[model samples]
Target chain A: MANAATTIDSPSEATIRERIARHAGAARVPDRFKIIADTSDFFRVDYNDVVVLGERAFWIKGYEKEGRFGLDDELKYWVRRAIDLADGTTTILKLVFHEQFETRIGEVAITCFRSPKKEARILDLVADHPNFMHGRWSRDTAGNIIRILEYIPGRRYDEIIAEYGAGHEEYFHRFFPRVLAEYIELVQAIKFLHDHGEKHGDIRRDHIIRDSERQVNRWIDFDYTYRHGESMFGFDLQGLGNILIFLAGRGDVLVPDLYRDQRQLFDTLWGEDLNISYKNRVANLKKIFPYIPDSLNRVLLHFSRGAELYYETTDQMLEDLATAQAALALHTGRGS
Target chain B: MSTQTFGDLSRRDVERHLLVAVDESENSKRTVMYLADFFGGLKDVFITLLTIIPEPSEDFFPTEAARAKWLRDRRAVMEQAMAGYREILRAVGLEDHQIESRIVIRPCASIGAAILEEQEKRRCCIVVVGRRGISHSEEFVFGSTSNHILHHAKNSAVLVVE
Candidate 1:
């Protein structure tokens, strides 16, 4: 009879299985548990840490990316330091391979990393700059690493809008203030990075970590950070403008008149005569966001006016943002 | 050039005199050659060669005698390189009176600071430098000296030749 295990259709699958088997043999897991499933992306092993080592154990994430990139040792040193400084109630360990596993011990989540080098730097930065991020790490059986982040535990603003539907003008009134606050905080974090001579190149919604309990939202992921002194002010502002458009829901509503006003101001101050491509995109803004009210769109466009003056300095931008926020509050009677 | 007319020139106009800055690397030779070609006809151009020597740290301390010997060896090397640069200038048909060369020895840690100090003292208009590859620290992913000078120098336009 032919061996059923070796009868996999794909060569890649077979290779992955072989690699996982080798790792499983070397892995320090209980003998009662075995390698239940394996793949090129990850390996799922069944093992009881309690039975083998007299401790509650969980699954180990065997990563292939770690094997390819190898360990960045310098980064690991920093990661270790950040973890030590973080809340130590949960057990978090750094593993040899490049993977992170997170387990919940009671109420607190334990986060670990296989290669702590890059992620550790990120964690340190987030901890030092609370306005920037909220991240943590933990380790797993078989020496795999895991990162247990506080899941962004709230609904997206757009989702909330859709769920409430029509006949919910009161709901809109209740949520608008909170939405504006979130936008202001996000902009503040961006300004902070700029003031510190750094550029947070990636500023997507996914990268924005929100903690509703603390009424705080922080920017995360510093892999794309560039020293502000080295990059052109024009380029940085361009990125900031693009991020604003992205956050405004990519044309789901009317292109805010505030966006247009800001673009004009940006052009005048920065001398950034955006090419035909950008002009065309901006001209057709109404098509992109049909749902947004004309008044709200006008406010959005006004919000961009400060962006034009971003080239002066981050401090100036922050001051402008504060003024704009005040004006917006007065107009809306939000009394912020 | 009339003295009264010279005074009438704006700061920008006076600072337009191109100053080519070079290191002691092999690539600096190419940089010098390229700069010479670029500013060949410019009348008020000045070329200054600066070499940053790493100061003896605790990890690299030498005996008194060894330090003296090392200084002598470095001076000899610098003298030879200056001679080669003079020949390069001559071969490129640069007027002997128009071209000026100086070899500066400064601490490596403050190379950027030294360059800025020299530029201010010399009233340099534009700075021509060689582009270096990745460094060990990864602090400045691009050429460190060029990037530093570009950021810190208020009056100079930096031209980095790869």
Candidate 2:
């Protein structure tokens, strides 16, 4: 209860709608629609109220993938916000459309771990982990499988970064703590999955959500999480590291970097150095803003670049996150 | 010489059929005017003004009085909405015989599909419709009826007025 004053309220209905509309526009096709059933009795465009079935709302999320292969072509991967459709609800409907990919920049492996059953399994493996959304599964009449799970209400982590990370001296400091807390929580999330012998295949920034109330960050989408014969949670950890830099506005550093070249500072994130893989290194948060406190910077730096001293297990990462969170919080015990 | 179904027209006088969908919206009104301006004088065109009334909101119950009132209100609304369309078509040179109208009350399902089906069955060469030209994001959640017909009406050439 100590962090009461610091707990940010969720945006108003109007604001949420405006934001969802803007965010929904990111998808390539005209997709952000609710499928109206014979239940035409009720049709509302209010974003806060999702399409409800059997007294609960199911939110349909589609992240746009543009030209990952074809020139100017686009596709959206649909994920039904289940499990948490309601506070007590646990099953969700997940839709997937088969698509092809071709790209010279990277090996285009489409539909590798796209089984609904696999996502259900991953959720079960990480259930009660506080960070991963959990659910059960059943198929609809159309044979489209429904993965029921908790529906976490929040914007994507990257959406927030894109929305608020203006890097203005005052606003940056004001919003950075919560954003940092989200990263730390996500680290714990991945660590929790890893310790239990599971991997969250896709850990992209868009795959993570900062709950509407701004209380916690939750990792989402196991569609491409699994890698064949790939051991060690390092991949997920590295992803979390990259997301940290991304959430800090691509570490753009519009101002001159007094101590280090801006290009060198972001080498890990943008693949400036040929040697470092996208997941291997992450830019330091300090690169974005020199005013970023050293304690927070050190944690992100170690997580991003340091190998051995870095978090090998989630507990190790969790311990440091606790410290960083405590040092940065206006008050202890983030009970919103 | 033989007149088709409704009687009193010659077979050799077969008219090119046009199906135009109308709703309560101003865009639909624009569509009516557009059809009149573009196809009014086409050699022999039979124009069908189609108005699809989606089943009333969920709360309209099965009670006799409620059902009767719903029916009465829907007919009144449809007639009122189509009055302007009928006048515009007639004003543009279509006689009572050349121009006709029908209102469909959907028990359930899509207005777009109904328009396409009617256009195909009626051998309507061209389907005139109103395009709200809504944003993809809005169309994503709430589909644009005109946009759907334009893409899915394989048998008919759709003319959408924005």
Candidate 3:
């Protein structure tokens, strides 16, 4: 398996050690507890002090970038703030995890850690994708494991809504095509994970981070990530449906809401079920506002409609999303 | 009740901690069931059921007995409201220790703020609440609790169960 520590192909054992050596100075983190950056989202990680999540403390033997991203034996939430000494920028650090079991064996409080092996395997399994967060781990003198992960400097989905979604129906309308593409990338990101024989156990809007600057999406918190087996990938698909609705609806305001009512837009993804026929799905969405592009509605139905507009695989879902994206461009009269 | 507190839930190994804030509305009761079905499958989850009640009027009683009765009555009603949540959690296979229900009393009665406060204290990853709890007119005048949490709960994911 390729190393989860390095993004490119295998960084030799020496290479990994050298990269660690280089980053050690970059992530020197002046004061263990201090603000390293002052961006708009500074408070997002700054307000809260370094909370180890579950445990009171865990030690890190090497630089955070060198620590493997894996499960620990003790079950506790630990939040670490780290700075990139090279760029002097800070990113919040959290680990992809496993279930830690605590047992009472005689009088001793025996706590066993989750092996880092599974996380390493999963990272190697999905190594081809740059969107998945890279993880490394290090242990302190006490043997407490410190797992490290990629920290993207981007706003969460909710923050986007709060900043522009409050009363901006026109903004969403003008950017409908762009929104469709972003959603498409989101679907593709998941497809990559699913195609790689893994499933993101938990998929929420917050987990689908938007790197606006890079114009890309990254999935985080692999706590629920596991190898795909017999599942149809329905859970995450439906979750994407839910996310689309929330974004389109701009969140439910009891006073007739802003997004849906303002533009006469339909809540196509809301309460969608497999039983709903594809034609009816399109019809229902159109009834709300006739201008809703048929192509866009069709794509929505593919996920919502069980048998008729159904997609068997996410790869298929990705292909049709491309078609939908092209059609959306024409509908909104925008270039792809 | 096992009296298992959510405080002891392992933060490191926590699959997810979901906080559902409900009221006496049937929709609120349904919220618990919805949560049970949607997020119930996770093996290592902690569900905190929270309810907010109006603070008793200081002038409601001229005598100590009246105050006692008032407090007792409020507790009884809140406990009765929470019973359905307990039943649903049990029915869904959550261990006794995994379920926690708390009733918070605030005289000002800002249910939304209280819910956010509880979320902060517990650090719940998700906050699920019922959308039908307040009337449309009330929402227009007072703003809905769900909206307040939706806009303010930056770190915690907000789910409005309709």
- The clash numbers for all candidates, in the given order, read 28, 22, 22
Q: How well is candidate 1 docked (DockQ)?
A: 0.07
Assess every candidate by TM-score: 0.46, 0.41, 0.42
Winning model by DockQ? 1
- How should the candidates be ordered by lDDT, best one leading? 2, 3, 1
lDDT of 2 by residue, A202-280 (tens): 5666677677764666777775532221113444554565566565444433223422565655443433211122333
Model 3 residue runs over 4 Å out of place are A1-76, A83-97, A100-128, A138-145, A161-169, A226-232, A251-285, A302-310, B1-162
- Measured against the true two-chain complex, the DockQ scores of the candidates, in the order shown, are 0.07, 0.01, 0.01
Model 2 ranges with Cα > 4 A deviation: A1-73, A77-92, A95-112, A125-130, A140-145, A148-153, A165-168, A213-215, A228-230, A248-275, A278-282, A285-288, A303-310, A326-336, B1-162
For residues B42-161, write the lDDT of model 1, one tens digit per residue. 555445555544332221111346546766677678777766766676676655654556666544434566677777766677777777653221221112567677778868788888
Between candidates 1 and 2, name the one with more favorable DockQ: 1
Model 2 Cα shift for residue B57 (angstroms): 50
Q: What are the candidates' interface root-mean-square deviations?
A: 15.6, 20.4, 23.4
**Residues A263-334, model 3: lDDT tens digits:** 434333343432121112222243344566666556555444332433435776677668767776776677
Q: On TM-score, who's better, 1 or 3?
A: 1
